[model samples]
Target chain A: MYENLPALKKPRVAVFELASCAGCQLQILNLEDELVDVLQLIEFAYFKEAMSNTSEDYDLALIEGAVTRASDEQKLLEIREKAAIVGTIGSCAYPVGIPGLKNSGDVEAASELVYGAKAALFPSVPVKPVDAVIDVDFHVLGCPIEKDEFLHTLTALLIGKKPPIPPYSVCVECRMKENVCAFDRGETCLGAVTRAGCGALCPTYGSRCYGCRGPADDPNEPSLEALLEKRGKTPEQIAADYALYNGYREGTAGRREAPDG
Target chain B: MFDRVIGKSDLTDSLDNLAERYRVVAPVSEGTRYRFAEIDGARDLDEGYIPTALPPTKYLRPPRENLITFAWDDEIQVEPVFDQSDFILFGVRPCDLHAIRLLDEIFDREKDDGHYQARRLGASIIGVECLEPCDEHCFCHAMGTLEAAAGFDLLLTDAGDGYYVRVGTDKGRQLLTELSGAREAVYEDRRRLRKIHARRDQAFEPRLDVEGSQIPALLADSNDSLLWDVLGEKCLSCGACTNACPTCFCFDVLDDLGLDLKSGTRYRTWDSCQLEEFAMVGTGESFRQPRDMRVKHRFNHKGRYLVERYGMPGCVGCGRCGRDCLVGIDPIGVFNQLKGQPVERR
Candidate 1:
């Protein structure tokens, strides 16, 4: 899709990070078969995860992790200025990841819990999605990016076609695979309310969905809560589950306090 | 008006006769719910039935589909698979028919999806207009899908004594012509069809009063609404809504290896965006980390982004989300709440 596009002409691609585990970058590396093809397609101007060399001007920039510190604040601005298309690679870049849960509690208290007296070494402020700092052209959602999806997005970029993102929830895929109800197994699965694109991997492996990819398009949260209640989960329990990852973002956990009633 | 009329009692014989010539799929009672399944005989057709367990789209777009077949070797030959068969979809609800139209807009537009297009092009749609609402969870009226506008080969209206058939496409006309007892739709039949639609409209209480066009604007304005944060706290992100939705069609491709590890088939399966790992990368970073943002993204995509990009609302108002929700988070309720309406708690 990018074959004839002017953007593809000597395309400069960059990969950057913030306060994160760098798992998303590892995922890109995991795309072993497609990595060489992608490398041949564009100029890998900046990638701290893969190489030592770096550059400022990039046509496309892939960002990982949330903005949690002063350095992240500066690094994100630099990336925004250098890259024309800035795409977020994981939940941290979009919803602040698990560290975002600190938004509810005292940042200093949480910092102390993690770093003790050296809490000053780590920024105690709450984390935010990459879009909170600069605009994002696209998003490849998941705890760790799906290797095929990474390749698919790159292929779309190469061919000049927009990569397709699953718009539905995990439940849809689960039903397609004919998996037994997670609730029937005495476990609360978020597959129904969660987004697809992970191919229902967690549920397939006997684990419930964690909303790692994010919510489905047009998520019915109240109804999901009621279903969870019917399956013997309390609103508090549901709230706790939601608070696990990127739940602390004001958009997610912050709204849990207010009931539909 | 034609003098010859058939009895509701004789409907079985008509269906049985039709089944001998073509594969007929109709609504059948399955446990507590109804599903559109193949009917070997007329007995399999459940006349007094509600909505199916899944939409008839399953026949059009199967759960797992083969996009292409490739042999693992230096010669990477790709062959597209198209499952186009001569089948008849009997007793499809008007809302489902409309849903098919929406699917056609997606799969049959621009660079057409050959697999979906082949099935759609070959298969025949026989619609059954609703005389009453499926259940309280249905909001087809709100979405203006209560009536079948088009996208069907044949439209069947239950008119007490017998079904009033309205031939839509050429295939429908040809099918009716083959039937010995079929006749032209009369004035009374048309009148009864209108009456059935009127009663159906009356049966469905308006669940959402917001205009369809205004949904994009409402979503844009409410991007930072407190409702998102409130619901995000409650959301488990199980992804039932997308699975139950008639229009949601995101999928993932996988290469299943054989025991020899030399050959594998690439299969595309349905995928959801609700799971935590969906947007995550290998570097242990998640983009849509906050449940609130994830929840908000889902709503915005369905209500705003899709319409902006595709010129259509992602939701068909099927209420599957409401029915399947573990927390009872109805999108209509959210929209109503966003619109400042009183939403009584379940």
Candidate 2:
């Protein structure tokens, strides 16, 4: 598809946001070392957080955050229509995130509690991931999105290649870093089934994985849940931890595996 | 029985000599555990260490090793990239040394993984004898891997004042010949080694539940055993066990593209079979989807499948799989489960 374009023309890139902590956008700005080299090679046509200049026509759109209201879905579909490729950055945009946790209960009523009297004029929908509303081309899975991974994804996307996504659980990276398991130290962790990409940052620093990244591709959630139960976690607590990031993800996620220890 | 002795000072001198010709790698302390890394000098080597967090196999096949790089424009261009570091892997434990042999066979047995063969050929191994078991997690004596009979260039035994060296191959002999102070071993050196051996036998415990020879037969009928279900309940299915395992060589191949939109690399990274997608096909049908089945396949692969196909059990009893396990679903512990012991402790 890129063959039709001129040999040396740089691709146009657009970075957008919805309902997120804006941490993923900050990661793009944090590419201090390669930012100059990367800037010379591409057109960062629309990144409001870092640059003043903006453009409508883009070759790629990087969406961060979740679709919490009807307006967000409309804006995302319009962006999808304009861009050649669309991918989401951060857990908020993938399967789900903290915002998506609102999907389980009354989001409209809760919005009143959080947003107050303004809820009368503005309408809302159940909080969910972007893909549930529109087709997403790729997912950069993490809480804020890791810097190295974002760069890797951008490099692949510019080359018209899909970046390699990890389907394995977080345990792979944790073991690689040689971090002692939280379970061994008498703490509960969701790392066994959480997706890798954050470099086991929490476990390496002596904190348990709260599953800030969503469930890994084909996670054995039931297995992890059962193991948690044996470790004395109640089913409600297991559901709460599992639902923290990816509670609104598709299918019966918790039904798959029955072991996590 | 090719024995020689080196004054403790000369051993460091020989390691310095090795550093001149090759990149020397050894287990170095990382707070509570040891990890394999490149050594600037022999002084960095941890003389007293446990099985490293990851096996020395990382030197043979790295976690994110590139297989080839390619560019596509008017024409497709491909170039195979081989890891070309000629290095020395020193101080690998007997269990891990045996694991290197296991990988050597697996990568070269059929299609010949050129990438692995290149790294394996580039490096020479120098092993250190475990006079006493490294810790309670070790069961190398039961697996017959307490001492590496071969697969090493030089083997060292720590005597009171100096190191007793056994040269196994041409590479070892060359290192010995280069060093000036290595003397022919005296009879007392042999007597000292035997005494250390006798004392160590009493120190190591929780031996292999069944004889190593009985593994193939015992696991053959384990499909119907209740062990898989019991294991599935405790196994977090996190895949920590396989990643730390020395003989578990399952890997996944991936393509990574650079921003040039034209050039990218194909990488073969370490993968674990315990993950659900390991056996999944394009149609999304997985042969080993259930946790119980995945748990069962790993043990059978270590104890039965590799044995049936290669006439040797895949496990080298490094105990990394057990010691690093957050849930303690270690190979020996599982074997004990099969033995009707069902014990769980360090």
Taking all chains together, each candidate's TM-score versus the true structure is 0.60, 0.85
lDDT of 1: 0.72
Put down candidate 2 lDDT per residue, B55-76, tens digits, no spaces: 8888888878999999988999
Winning model by TM-score: 2
Error of 1 at A2 (Å): 30
lDDT tens readout by residue for model 1, A1-261: 122333455478898887778999999888776666566667888899899987777898888887777778788888878776777888777655676776656778888998998988877566667776676667788888787777666655554555656656777667655355577567877776566778888887778888877666546676667777887788777776776555644433354221000
Q: Compose the digit string of candidate 1's lDDT tens values, residues B1-346.
A: 3322344556567778878988888888854557678898788888887766567888888778877776657766667788878888888887788778878888898548898999897788888788777676777777667778787987777778787777788787776644456556767767776787778667777777687668778888887678877777677666666666677777767654332223446777655566555676766577987777877888887778877877755776777667666666888888888888433333
TM-score of decoy 2? 0.85
Model 2, retained fraction of real contacts? 0.57
| Residue-by-residue lDDT tens digits, candidate 2, A129-187 | 87777767777878888887887876765554546566777888888777777887778
Window of ten residues with lowest summed lDDT in model 2 chain B: B337-346
The worst-scoring run of ten residues by lDDT in candidate 1 chain A lies at A252-261
Q: Is the docking of candidate 1 incorrect, acceptable, medium or high quality?
A: incorrect
lDDT of 1 at A69: 78
List lDDT for all candidates, in order: 0.72, 0.79
Where model 1 places Cα greater than 4 Å from the true spot, the runs are A1-174, A177-261, B1-10, B280-286, B341-346
Per model, state how many residue pairs clash: 95, 9
